[model samples]
Every structure is written in structure tokens, then in C-alpha cells.
Target: MAQQARAVVTRAAIISGAAAVFQQRGYGSTSLADVCAEAGVTKGALYFHFDSKEALARAIIESQHELSSAIGRDLVASNMRGLNAMIVMTLEIADQLHNNPVVSAGVRLTIEAANFASPVDAPYLDWMKAAEVFLRRGQVEGDITETVEVCSAAHFLISGFTGVQVVSDVLTRREDIQQRLVEMWHMLLPGLVPTDRLADLLTLPERIRASRQAALGQH
Candidate 1:
């Protein structure tokens, strides 16, 4: 049991090391030797756990999702839904992109997924699926317009966020992502929410930030 625990720790270390390398060198340029050096593991040890660089990249992407899903899981437990859930999820993701190296690397690897013969797309699909669910619930709750097509809106919102973050990463290294997300919601919410509801949701981002700060301070 002790040995198995050590093996688990070693595997996590390797994944984290590879993520750091991938973040800096990107997928095409990163090599197994570099990963081994970064991870402080021998080739034999790495091979015991993973056969190829693609496997390691996939693991990194999976790790990133695990982090985000933990946040989503908590929100789910709280029964949060609709635009409130979507806004909080996106805000949390933006914070992760700015603060977490593994997540940042995961996004970078995902973008460079063409390097892999078959890219892992389950994470993206899963997020879009969740968005669809939230949008449908929003319509039922009267937070979303009946005229909106839930599936199409879900897809566009997910893709639009991708573009927003990618542009933020390029232009500001994501320093301004929170503000950018606020701008995004401002432009998009009017079409989704009732005119009466628009004013309240417009300030949701700021309220969410303040709530987080208060929660942290209490701890």
C-alpha cells in the first residue's frame, strides 16, 4: 500500500513536470528527455507509467478538467443553475487560466492538439454539454429568452469564450481576462435575458468577485 501511494505521487510529479515543459516549449518542441529531466525521473520510470508524449499531454489536459470539474461539482451540489452558474463557471475558469500553470499548459496543449494523431476532445464536449443544460434551465427559469436556441447558443458561447481567452492570453498573458469576461457578458446578456433582467445580471461578475473575497476573508 505504501509503495502504491509512492507510485501515485511519482506519477503526479511527472504529469506536473511535463505540463510545465509543455507550457514553455509547446507540444511539438517538447521531448521525452526534457520531461524526464523536469520530472526528476529516469527513462525506465517514465516508460513504466506512460508510453509516449501524447499520453502525458492527455493526462495534463485531464488534470486541467479535474480542477475545473471540482469547482463545477461544488456548484452542482449547491443547486446553482442558469446564467448564474454559467457566469461563475467561466469566471472560475478565467481565474484558473491566470493562476494555474497546469491549466494554462492544458489549454496550450489543447490548442496544439493537431500534433497528436487523435486529439482528446471529451473535455471540450463535456463543457459544451454542461452549457446546453444550463441554458435550457435558464429558459425554464425565465432567465433566458424563449426565442434563443439552447444548443446553438451553447455552442457559440463556448466558442466565443475560447476566442476571448486566446486573445487575452496573446495580448495580455490573461492579465485582463476577468475584465474581458465582464465585457463579453455585457454584450451577450442583452440578447439572452429579459430587458428587465439585464441590469441585475450586468453586475453579476462584480458581485461574484466580492462574494469570493468575502468568503476567503472569513477563512
Candidate 2:
């Protein structure tokens, strides 16, 4: 039992270290020796945990997908639905990107490898498909518009979230940009929300930010 626990910890440590190194250096530029050095594990240890760098990369992809799926399930279970949940979840993801070192680095690394033909696409492809499923559900529940174009809306949201992350690191006015994006979602989402509740459904980013700040200030 002790040996099994130690093995799990060692594997996690290696994977985390590999992710950090890959995030700092592109996958192609990163070598097994680098991962081993960062992981503080012997080459044999790394090979025992993962047969090859490609295999490790694949594990990273699966790890990210599982993390994303867990978050999605939690968001949906919280009585949040449709576009509202998406926007909130995406903002939370952005917040995580800003806050979590491993997650931010892993996200950046995964995105950088996104253009290449690799298994890294599997996670995001599954993510987009999940988003589409959510959209379809929203339509059925009368939260989304009947005119919904699932694929296009899903792409737009994904691209918008990706764009926000790409610029988040460089932008000095991240708060303002995030505000603008929430506003943009409000403006655009009406076209996708049911007409009867469109006005009731939309919430301004500024308002949400103000409320968030107020609540935080209370603490």
C-alpha cells in the first residue's frame, strides 16, 4: 500500500513537472532529459511512469480534459444553465489561468500545440462537442433560441475564450477587457436567447463586477 501511494505521488510529480517544462519550452524543444531534470526523477523513473514524451503529452491532454469535464459538471449542477453558465465558467477558467501556475502553463502549452497535427486536439474537440451538447439542451429547455446554430456559437465562444487567454498575459487593462467581453456576450447572446426572456436573461459585466467587488469589500 505504501509503495502504491508513493508510486502515485511520483507519477503526479513527474507529470506536473513535465507540464511546467513543456509550457516554458515548446514540446519539440522539450526533451525527456529536461522533464527528468525538472521532475527530479531518474530517466528510468520517467520511463516507468511514461514510456515516451509523446505518451506523457497524451497523458497531459487527458488530465486537462478530465479537469475540464469535472468543472463543467459542477457548473451545470449549480442551477446555472446555457449561456450564463458558459460565460461564468469561462470567466472562472480565465481566473484560473491567471491564478494557477500549472493550469495556466498547461493551457498555454496545449494552445500552442493546437495548430499542429497532434492528439492534443482530442481534449478540445471533446470540449467543443460538450459545449454543443449544452447548447442543444438549452434550446430544449427554452433557454436558448430556436434559431440556434450550435457549431457556430460553440466556435465563437471557444475562440473568444482562447483569445482572452492569449491576450490576458500581455494586457495591462485585463479588467477592462474582461468587462468588455462580458458586455459583448450580453449584446451577442440575446440573438441566441429566447426572445421572451432575452432582457431578463442578460446581465451586464459591469454590474456583475460591481456586485463582486462590493461583496469582496465587505470581507
lDDT of 2: 0.71
In the range 1-219, model 2's lDDT, one tens digit per residue, is 999998999999898898888877867889999999999999998999998777787677567667766666786667656665666666656555665555665666676665555636654665576677678778887888878899988877777767766775667424444665676677667778877787777764455556655775799
Work out the TM-score per prediction: 0.93, 0.79
Tell me how far the alpha carbon of residue 64 in candidate 2 is from the true structure, in angstroms, after superposition: 1.7
* Ten residues in sequence with the least summed lDDT for candidate 2: 172-181
Over 130-169, each residue of candidate 1 has an lDDT whose tens digit, in order, gives 7887888788888898899888888888888888999999
The lDDT per prediction is 0.86, 0.71
Residue 175 of model 1 has an lDDT of 89
For TM-score, the strongest prediction is 1
